[model samples]
Target: MLADGGSRGLLRKTFGELGLLSLSAFLFAFSFPSFISVDGLWPLVFIALIPIVPVIHRCSWAAAPFYGAFYGFLSYAVFNYWLTTFHPLAIFIVPVIYAVYFLILFPALKAVDLFFPRYAYWIQAVVWVGYEYLRTQGFLGYPYGNLGYALYKVLPLIQISELTGVWGVSFLIALIGFFLGHALLFTFEYDASFFVSLKVWFSRRKAALAVCSVLLVGTLIFGFVVMRGSYDDQRPWKVALIQHNADTWKGGLPTYRRNLRTMIALSDRALAADEPEAVIWSETAFVPGVDWHSRYRTDSERYALVEELRNYLADKSVPFILGNDDGQKADPGLPPVLSDGRLNRVDYNAVLLYENGKLRQTYRKTHLVPFTEHFPYKKLFPGFYQLLVDHNYHFWEKGTEYTVFETDNGVHFSTPICFEDVFGYLSRRFVRNGADVIVNLTNDSWSGSVAAQMQHMGMAVFRAVELRRSVIRSSNSGMTCTINPDGRLTGMLEPFAEDYYIGSVPIYAERNTLYYHWGDWFPLVMLSLGLVLLLVGGVRKIVLRKS
Candidate 1:
């Protein structure tokens, strides 16, 4: 009977532990994007403190998985919910992968505590960040909703991100969590014995306090440096961002013309004014794949559109860059039309740059959206190709190389579409390729929520600092703005509003940053430390038993 009662108590404790995880998830969801940023309740982040309190007190190794999984679900559900709009199955698969990371993280934390008892929080924070770093590395580096993005509005706090990449901001936040956790859980009443013992033993409070003070001071110093940086120059460049509110519901060529008209009209008005040197448009604003404008049997309709666009730019005497599906040339070694007549070819989604009333250059997107642009492992299961079609998901051929275009002033530009700006490597490459300003042409109307837009915008901030190059983002459903070289938002357009927004982009030659050279080093070092601790713990256990 006593044994039975003990088992019941264990089950109850497990369930309670799981409940704490659910509360954490709820707190995270509430404090994040849609609710916190959009609703303007910035203090909700502190409210999230409620759930984090218990985790520090007892340090639940077993509950870490449950908490991680729960928070992962809540995170993706709200932030990447746009994935589901593309394909419903993604909603399930993504969260499962995210939850698995949490599962791995929690048990590992418990194992580390065995060796680094007093410094478990340090180990835990680093290991967790290392996992996040790994997620942004190789084939699976999806760094969406990373805690670093939470400081999108707090430009002053995130200036250190330029030196450390997103991991720097994440490290500070994690350290704060560690110090708070230790403060809540540890039992030390400052007895005379304890006071004397302090001479021999290091106090966790002193160490945590020191780290916190350093971080706070470092952040302030970084902010002052960024603010005083050259991006604060007030030189104006009469820039224009065209909002072509295209309908994603329709497919094929008919809707493409309608989308072009919307962009063209917006461009006409943009040029009607001071005739800015360059004007930007959202992704896929034009369809140049057909026999349109090119010398090879140009269609009358295409000729007319090109001529009209050229004339429009000539009349305004300004350059325009827009997103379009410039279909591919007949390439050998690639498959022809499938049995369903869906061209297995055609590299869609290319950003065409028109300068001085002529097509100057085009930058094809390199990092295509997973499942949306390229199906994962379609070669393994040919059957999934049909599943892609049934869901109306478009599979565009990936771009082979990075291309940058130059303006008359010798300012080179590279354009990334949609979430491509979120990829730090992609932006870094642009800067490496001699791009003065990074222009991202994206269409986020499908997201249908301001929370998702702000989150997307937040990720762009790191890129500005990473390359030390200004970023000009032109989006269809809001958040069109220019980020200075120091990651400061100089100007912004309102969300869900349709109007031409203009801002001057500071042209600074890309300079090398420490983070741009050696990426993810901090997290790598921490993960290595965690692994070493675990190994030491295992070895010590064996030696003690043998003794």
Candidate 2:
């Protein structure tokens, strides 16, 4: 007992819980997009959470939640450093929310570890995935830092997203970290080297190792096979995506006119090619409401600009698609705000499609970026809400529909405006409802960070795989590209450059993927199974104590 105490003391002295927590936080920070670079040290993610496990395993139950909270806040504070550019207060809000998340999460994890000692690691991994799923739901759904995204460049491994909606990949990686964490914990307890401890640990855990290996190998083989699976129902498709290189933040008729001219110039260049079916512009590319100005004509300058754009589209042979505000009569609800005078029109972040010089279809963005685009707690947090408004943050009315658009040429697609593509379920819903392709129109220029742009672009890879539909991201100021059904990126335009990419996109009329059919089932199942196991563990503990 005295020797055991000495060993444990030495372990704590050599690497304290705070030290391990800081190590994990730094690893977690660098594992995603940070100031380091766009394509971060992604390889570190495989073992990123390994150090945290010992901190989790050894900490007193009272200390577990605080340690977890600190880890969460520190990790995200570093990873989401770019959020400071989004808004000064954003950095605090995001990390504090994560801190609160882990405050609750770690205690539950510690409980499971205490009760289900043998299967704790596996169950904890499942819980981690469940946490991710829960976090990315409803108004606060932010999908950055998801473990699966680190594997965006590893095409073969991430093909599992088509099966499990990125949650499966999270589970696999988390499980690997748990196994490695256990080995590290052994070394710490025994004062032995990691390699010797890992070898000893591996011999005792052959069954778990085999299962994990089989899963890893199986997914790789599946990926290779899926990559080879040709889309037999594909058709010849061509679309032009324009990057006007204009700052989306700039306003007034002067900035709008300059942007419009830049786009028209870029469009002319694209139109010079074999007649493309459609030309796409980034989200909110045209700041003025085309619909409102064309009819209201209340502001002659804005109205004339809208007419100029309409005339340009009318003269073109191809369908014109661009993001603009769609103003409709307001029947607004939560986060109440004033409508435009007696016009009473509430504007939505919307995409408009022009066919034969007439407006053919419109897809209003359903998923709004949480505080920046749509805030719901106006009455409850009026002062804070006004502060957001004071910070030059404007809000839009949320459009409540999964709108699929069809062109005059018989092609069908959905424009998931901006970060809507980050949510797999939204893309799945679009595919299930007959969107042949996913064209994400985005204005990432406001962030003014290429690392931020790359991080945003990376998530689109999974959306393509999950639905087996092609994803074409058209962004203002960066990352205009098409991701094929197999999660391959091609025909990319230079970021922040005045350029355009005309891709001969292959329209895959392939059947929807498993992820589309059963959307987010893996995470749901893991959450449900976790609750059941925890309940069972509680009952067993009670029975054992009584006996």
The candidate scoring highest on lDDT is 2
lDDT by residue (1-547, candidate 2, tens digit) is 9999999996775468879888888887787766786777888888998997777788887888888799889888888888887888899999998999889888878878788777777988988888888999988999998998878878999998988988998899888887788777878876568778778878888998899899899999999998998754579578899999887557678999999999998899888865788899999899889988776676789889999999988877688889998876565442223444455568899999988899888888898988888899999999989989998887988888898899878888999999999999899888888889999999888777787888888899999888888899999887899889888987788888998888866788656678887899999999898888888888999999999
- Deviation from native of the Cα of residue 4 in model 2, angstroms: 22
Residue 278 Cα positional deviation in candidate 2, in Å, after optimal superposition: 1.1
Residue by residue across 1-547, what tens digits does model 1's lDDT show? 9999999987886666566656655555555566445632333443343344444334466566666676567656665665665457777767777888776766676665555667766776776677777777654557776666767667787777767777777767666665455444342334446445453333535766787788778897878876685744544355799876554336644566676667777777777765677888888766655222454323566666655555666654467788877665555454444557555446667888777666778788877877667766778877877787787777877787788888776668889888888887788787777777789988777767777777788889888876777899988876788888777788888877767876787777636787667755666787787677778877997898999
Looking at model 2, the pairs that clash are: none
Q: Among all windows of ten consecutive residues in candidate 2, which has the lowest summed lDDT?
A: 332-341
Give each model's clash number: 3, 0
RMSD each, Å: 4.3, 3.4
* lDDT of candidates 1 onward, in order: 0.69, 0.85
Q: What TM-score, computed on C-alpha atoms, does each candidate reach?
A: 0.86, 0.94
